[model samples]
Target: MVAYGFKRWFSPQIQDGTKTHTIRGHRRRHAHQGEELQLFEGMRSLHCRKIIPDPICVAVLPIVIISSDLIDCGIAYIEIDGLPLHRDEIEPFAVSDGFSPDRLRGIAPAALVASTARETMGRFWRSTQPGSRFEGVLIRWRS
Candidate 1:
């Protein structure tokens, strides 16, 4: 089984099934649909723990996150499997990835609560390099 690790704070959402997808950097061997996936917290650490029963990977798709020239203004373009996301869909998508403003209270700026998920995600993905582009994978489980 392919294993994926998450931070401890994500346990509640992962266990409750609210968060069913994860965005990650490319893997040498990408996960395939129908594969069993192991979810863990703190992999390779002494505090490691299983977060949930293994879940079947229902989908695995290409994902790209690009920061806009207006990145500082909270603008970004995101695509999944080559299709771009509509403006209205960003928030729900972000929530599914466990980045809802309320959930990011301490890790994100206080201004985030008043900002859109696009802003939150933009700031997050661009934390290190505001203009960087991220090519990754989106792994999902049936809800």
Candidate 2:
């Protein structure tokens, strides 16, 4: 099974069926739909220090790419079948596309657009430079 690793803070959101979509750098080869993804935590920090063995969450969810855009930079929205998690709950640090305020305004409703500037939801509009090959991927989480 294909496995993806996330930070400790965000991993639980996935396991609990809270965060359904993950926006990330695009992948040259995407995981096929209906494939079970092994969820791992602390993989990013594993190279830095020898931490305790991280437990692998048994929850495997099917994911799909629901949206892709190449305007400012390439981005893919992957959707997972799980309970919807609002942006406030996750509390992202920064918005990936904050540089393009107009884009955010255009796509999101006026109310949402207004909230994008607030601290809680600001990260959603934050600018994130696209990766060399792939912009990003949105992974949908499924219970």
Candidate 3:
């Protein structure tokens, strides 16, 4: 149902045509799913100032835009299950635990993350070094 190593631009509805209903696509997509106990309660409410205890999931890819090994200005991330997403490499960090997360809604957000979709474009990812912190638990979405 989801096999985008690159090529998806965007989608939020499900339907084809001929009176099927539920077809959505404007352009903008990426993917990833390798492991999970469950993540995305809305990215666990976006929290992470630094909560290290047992980091090391290393499945990467939550965001990407073609910067390469970021941190030049301090803007590169990858803390899935702990929410830090902002580095895509053919975005594919949510299949082993894929359900949701990596959405853009009506498309419009870039005060931090960027994209080009190759799964987002030129990825190397970052984050998770605060003593290798990232065991899990940071997805929050309540609405």
Q: What is the TM-score of each candidate against the true structure?
A: 0.83, 0.41, 0.21
Candidate 2 Cα errors over 4 Å, as ranges: 47-121, 124-135
CA error at residue 66 for candidate 2, angstroms? 17
RMSD of 2: 10.7
At residue 49, candidate 3 shows an lDDT of: 22
Q: Candidate 2 — number of clashing residue pairs? A: 22
Q: Candidate 2 lDDT, tens digit per residue, 64-113? A: 32222342222223234444334352223124213123334544444434
Backbone clashes in candidate 3 total 31
Alpha carbon lDDT of residue 29, candidate 2?
Answer: 54
Q: What TM-score does prediction 2 earn?
A: 0.41
The lDDT per prediction is 0.77, 0.40, 0.25
Q: What is the lDDT of residue 63 in candidate 3?
A: 26
- lDDT for position 42 in model 2: 59
* Highest TM-score against the true fold, candidate: 1
Pairs clashing in candidate 1? Answer: none
